[model samples]
Target chain A: MHWKEDSAEEGDLLRNALAGCEKAWADLFRMHYHRVYAFAFRSGLSAEDAEDAAQEVFVKAARYLETFKGDSAFKNWLYGIAHHAVMDLLRKRGRREVLLERLHENDTTSKCSAAAKHTEVGDVLGQLPDDLRMAVVLIYYEGKTHKEASKIMDCAETTVSWRIYIAKKRLRKLLEKRG
Target chain B: MKDDPIEKYLVKLEVPTPQQEAVERALHRSTLAFKNRVEPKITQRENTVFKWFEKYYLAVAFAIVFAAFASFFPWAERVCPAASETSDLLAIYSEVKMLFQNNLVAVLLQGSELKVQLGVPRNVAGARVMFVEFSRGDEKIKVLCLEGSALRVPLQGKVQPVLEAMPTADGGVILMGDSFVWSRAMPQTINGYNISARLL
Candidate 1:
């Protein structure tokens, strides 16, 4: 019942936002910023980069509001924008390779103790391929349903399920070595 | 998926969150950008009579209704006007109960005449009302109004329903439907009805 009410309120907010109500748009930004920032951070961006990416996502969403029909959850649409912005940032900086190389160089330091390994989950996540890492970040840390994740990730729903399955197997192996 | 240690650890991963200051900064920037984009339209609206109505239609409409009822019925003023946030037509409907009938009148847009079946249920009523149709792709909805009552077109293809029926003080009945819109543009033709109305 609460879910229904929230959905109705969200629908109204979307309508108002699309109709150019700045207050509604700002409310939407505040409500979803954390998740978009978390997705960017978990994808291995620095704090500054993630914040920038999240802000860009919201601005772009406002610019493209007319294109968003009431076809899916607003967050799904938003995450789609965040995904592209973060990926673009990563591509422009060549940041993925740099982060992966840094992860490898830190492997010796992580191998020193179980305590060290436990502290290295955030670093090790950078070593996962981007697709799998994003799947993991969105589903696990960000707590999106598989279907919603699929829409944001621009893939089939079953593919999201498979990515999550594969990501878990990989994360389990990495975390076990750390422990 | 559930109770997996790996999942637990992943959930525990420390991720960066935007600080409150950062959030406020971003919101201000976005809102400013949106305002800039929309400023011209707002400027244009400021000079329009319709903009005047859009802003003050409620207070003025309520004042008119209140004055009409204030003479004999002291309780009329105390009756809360429906908050004007919804639509102007709705405000009128709430004050005048007789206008709530779901009577279907086949509106021939060209004639500006509402065809009325005198004794039939939901077939007719009286008054000049505006009908507006909005469409996105193939989806369409018609907002119908009469006197002060209005209703949305049914998606199930049924004729519009009568919203309310009440006898007026003059020994006659006023039939109305509970639906209305703030604007209307005639479509070339309603799907199942025909008229010489200019529709685009």
Candidate 2:
């Protein structure tokens, strides 16, 4: 499902959630769970780990709802939380190299065309460092501008631009080698 | 940008959607966790006290350290030596006057003791040092009441006189001779001045 940026609706849901409305919290969780999951997955987490990371993001958002002063879009704020949650899970599990190996093995073995392509993409992303991979995923897969990607990744715009440039160069080299 | 092959692959990458049942389960868990969360209720008075400590914690810590050092170490009292020494001198004078009025001379002059005299006060390291003399024939026992400062006892004669110094509670010292029998009237000195004694 395509999730549009609706600040007014999100603000109302957030206010009701803060006012102890459980249904409002559930609504907010359902609305953003898919995008958070997809973000985690495209950021080099396994499907199961992405699900866990998404759940963690919503729980944290609910916990720190008051700190959101509506300075930026709630989507950006939620993506910020998602970014940290995914990175923390990655760091704690120490499975980046292992996941890369697994993705390469799946890319070579998978017979289905769509699954092969998806695994190939994951394998290529897994080759980039965590920061550069996040830059590529946020810009290309998530369709965020450099400004929004910088905010989500907690870096300067120039840094994001630099990372994307380096990441694209390396990805082209990697894809050419595969071809 | 639109014709870029790498961007095209990344944009077309398909991420597996989480099952609807898993989403519902996660929502229920998050809702339960949110409802179970208890924010601490801070009263206005408690908040004010917290903010007060936050603001003046450095000054309060400094005062506590100063007070602790002053109580533990005698030399820290040198910071205000004049006031302490003066009060100690007054206490010693009042005790000596009471001893003289009671005709305690006979008890003090048990053997060859003739008389006792309070000498003039002298300044030593910003503290007043008073001398009490107990005379017996040609021999005299001198007691030095040194207060507020850690100054060495002043000895006028070449003789060492066998000095003994006892520390009082308020950072003062009582120095006396070994030959004399010191009948300690008050064992514990209050405000650093309890030197009421008769020499035998």
* Model number with the top lDDT: 2
Worst 10 residues of 2 chain B by lDDT: B102-111
lDDT (Cα, tens digit) per residue for candidate 2, span B74-97: 686567875765566456544665
TM-score of each: 0.49, 0.57
Worst 10 residues of 1 chain A by lDDT: A110-119
Q: lDDT of all predictions, in order shown?
A: 0.61, 0.68
DockQ each: 0.18, 0.30
* Model 1: lDDT of residue B186: 28
Cα RMSDs, all models: 22.3, 16.0
Tens-digit lDDT track of model 1 for B35-97? 654222444446688688889999999999888878568775675564332355444333332
